[model samples]
Target: MASLSLRQVIKRYRTGKTELQVIHGVNAEIADGEFVVIVGPSGCGKSTLLRMVAGLEEISGGEIAIGPRVVNQLEPAERDIAMVFQNYALYPHMSVFDNMAYGLKIAKVPKDEIRTRVDKAAKILELGHLLERKPRELSGGQRQRVAMGRAIVRQPQIFLFDEPLSNLDAKLRAQTRLEIQKLHRELGITSLFVTHDQVEAMTLAQRMIVMNAGHMEQFGTPEEVYNRPATTFVASFIGSPPMNLLHHAPGNRPGQILGIRPEHLDVASDGWPVQVETVELLGAERLVHARLGDEALIVRLHEGEGAPAVGSTLTVRPRQDRLHAFDATTGQRL
Candidate 1:
């Protein structure tokens, strides 16, 4: 495995004299064997950035390097990277073993070495029993695993995953995520994963790049991004209920927005007075949706705590240490 670097990377599309820049200058350093995920909402250019790294998309400016070589001019095949696409892209007629062996075959690897490599990958992916089965015969998760196994056999210096779990059901997605984690642990290949899913980004990434409107908002561990978001967008986008940004929160300065998470606020005898609008029971916890001077906020209540009745006025206090402050105009952390 080798390190990957993106220095002032930019991508632009030109039509006649009209030029549309999609990816702004993005810079990042991914260490060897580190799994970094590029995550954002759709149209945020996360996938485009990953494609640039994969050599599928040409860079309009700046440099991309894999290890010691600058790969801006390199073809995808010459980048020493294996890509796992969203659609699986498996050959229906080819069995699992044959599908995984096709690249080596094209490279003219010896038959015994091909067998050894394919066998090893199959064992790692727990697809040994399905080696003879065609893609059509396998389940969606199994097909994805087969795709991963195909990448494993090549043993590329880096792995690029482009929303590979999008097609799976919720349960299968969770299962496949575990499988991917195990695969990464076993292979230790440098991986760049691109996805719009925050949960996937949080759980799968060693370090995550949070992108917004073609800009890199933040690049840090999940905990760092979640706990100490660099921008209001990062604060609001990374969580389940999202961070609450109060424009006119009590004790807030004129041009500042107060931010707090649902779980970080507690029902108290004295604090911000809010009229309960709704309550949602989520088994182990409850979400209290309330209105505070036309501003909405959610307070998380753990099990054993009574859910407040709708239309009732209750006071919720945000944990002092957990509060976040941002500039209202810039939406940037203070």
Candidate 2:
């Protein structure tokens, strides 16, 4: 495995005289064996950036290097990277064993070596019993594992995953995530995973890159990104209920916005009065949607706490230390 580096990476699409720039100057230094995830909204250029690193898309400006070599002009095959696509590109006629062994076969590896590598990868992915099965006979999760096993047999310097869990059911997605974590632990390959799901990003990433409209918003561990978001876009995008940004929050200074998480606010008798608009019960916790002046905010109540009635006025207090402040004009954290 080798470290990956992106130095002022840029991408642009040209049609006649019209030019559209999609990726800005993105720079990152991903250490060897680190599982870094690129996450953002659908059109945020997360995939574009990943594609650039994979040598699938050409970089319009700047440089990309894997280990010590600059791979700006290298083909995908020459980049020493294996990609696991979302669709699980597999040969219908090939069995699990053949599918995993195809790459080694094409490279003219000896028959015994190919078998050994395929068997090793199958064992790692728990596919030893399914070696003779075809892609059509396997479950969706199984097929994805086959795809991963194929990448494993090649033992590339890096692994690139393009939303490999998007096609699975919720339960299967959760199970596959655990399998991937285990696989990473065993193989320890440098991986770059791209996805639009925040939960996947939070669970699978060692360090995550938060992208927004072609810009690299933030790059850090999940805890750092969730606790101390660098920008308002990150603060609003990373969480489930999302952080509340109050432009006209009580006691806020001019040109500043107050930010607080739903779980950081508590129901109190002497604080900001808000009228309950709606309440949602989610298993172990309750979400109270309320209107404070003209602004809307959500407050989370844990189990054992009584849910406030709708249309009732209640005061909620924000934890002083948990509060966040941002610039109104720039939408940047202060």
Candidate 3:
């Protein structure tokens, strides 16, 4: 396990006389054996940053260091990193054991050593019983595990996951997520997982990097980013259903955008008057979609709490300390 560092990393694409910069001077330091997730919406440069670190994409400026060595100019094989791609990248004709041992074979590792490493990885990934099956004979989750097993056997310094759960069903994704968490705990490998899903980011990350529009929005522990977002983009992007941003919201300073999460808004007697537009019952809780003048807001109501019917009027007040204020022009947190 080793620490990963990104210092003022930049990426650009040149088309004729024009240069389009995609990653803008991003900086982050990931501790050894920590699980760090890079999350954002599509086209936000999250994957680009990951590829850069994997030595697939060239950095336009600055440095990327894996452990003690700067890996910017090194080949992907020389980086001492293992990348598990989204597609599972397993060979259809190869057995699970062969798939896991392929890399070691390519590196000319001795046969007995490769067998020991593959057996250990198979045991770790719970693929020991299925080692004789080909990729076609295995289930999706099993194949994904085989992919992970291939990476695990290498015992690289860092593990890179590029949305490894995207192709699985909801239940499988959840189950595999737990498996990955357990794998991390048992192996204690340094990992950098890139995903656009906030749920994955919140659940899997010890710390996370939030990116938007070619720039890093915030980098912090999940608790810090969730409880106190550093920017409006972070506030809006990191949460489920996202934070509501209202211009000139009640009790907000002039020229500032008021931000509040649905769960933080409470039913109050003297609060912002809202006209209920829709209500969605989500088993344990209900989401109340309402209008406050021209702005739309969502309030989360727990079970046992009375829910407002559509076309009805109610008042929802944001908790004082839970409220977030951001600059109207720049969207930076205030």
Candidate 4:
């Protein structure tokens, strides 16, 4: 395992007349064996950053270090890192064992060592039973396991995953997430995963880097990002149903935007009057869709709490200490 560091990393592309910058002065330090997720919406440059670290893309400026050595000019193969791509990319004719062993073969590892490595990786990934089977014979999840098996056999210092689960169905994605967590615990390889899914970032990351418009919006534990978002973009992007950003809220000070989460707002006898528009009964909770004055808001209700009738007037109060205040103009937390 190896610690990874990026100092003021930048990526830019030349357009017809002007330069277009995609990643801007990003810096981060990932501890050895840590699982860090780089998350953002599509077109936010998360994949570009991951590519830079994997040495698949050239760095426009600054430095990238894997463990003790700087790797800015190193080729992808020389970086001692393994990348699992979105596509499984398994050779259809090759059996699982052959596909997993091909890299070592190309590197001229001894035949016995190749067998030992392939068998061990297959066992770890639960692909032992499918060793002789071709990629065409395996299920999507099984084929994905084969792709991972190829990476595990490399025994690289770092593991880079570029939205590896995006191809799986919802159920498979959830199952594979558990598999990945288990793999990390057992092997303890340093990993960087890139995704646009906030739930994946929240559940899988030891720490998360939230990105927007190529800028590093926030980098911290999931709890920190969810509970005390650093900016309005982070606040709005990290949560389901998102936090409410009110410009004309009762408690909002002049030139400040009031922020509150759905769960932090409760039905109160005397509070902000909200006219109910709709209600959605989620399995374990409920989402109340209402309008506070003219602005729409959503409130989360726990199980057994009755939802108010549509078109009815209801009062909701925010937990004072839980409220977030941001600069209205800059959207920075205040």
Please tell me which predicted candidate would have the highest lDDT against the true structure.
2
Better of 3 and 4 by lDDT: 4
lDDT by residue for model 1 (205-307), tens: 9999999999999999999999999999999999998999999988999999999999999888899999999999999999999988989998899999888
Off by over 4 Å in 4: none
Clashing pairs in 2: none
Residue 45 shift from truth in candidate 4, angstroms:
0.3
lDDT of each: 0.94, 0.96, 0.94, 0.94
lDDT for predicted candidate 3 compared with the true structure: 0.94
Per-model TM-score on C-alpha atoms: 0.99, 0.99, 0.98, 0.98
- Measured by C-alpha RMSD in angstroms, how accurate is candidate 2? 0.7
TM-score of model 4 vs. true structure: 0.98
Which stretches of candidate 2 lie above 4 Å from their native place?
none
lDDT, candidate 2, 1-334, per-residue tens: 9999999999999999999999999999999999999999999999999999999899999999999999999999999999999999999999999999998999899999999999999999999999999999999999999999999999999999999999999999999999999999999999999999999999999999999999999999999999999999999999999999999889999999999999999888788999999999999999999999999999999999999999999799999999999999998889
Per-residue accuracy of model 3 over 1-334 as CA lDDT, tens digit each: 8999999999999999999999999999999999999999999999999999999999999999999999999999999999999999998999999999999999999999999999998998888899999999999999999999999999999999999999999999999999999999999999999999999999999999999989999999999999889888999888877898899687778889999999999999988999999999999999999998899998999999898989999998889888888998889989
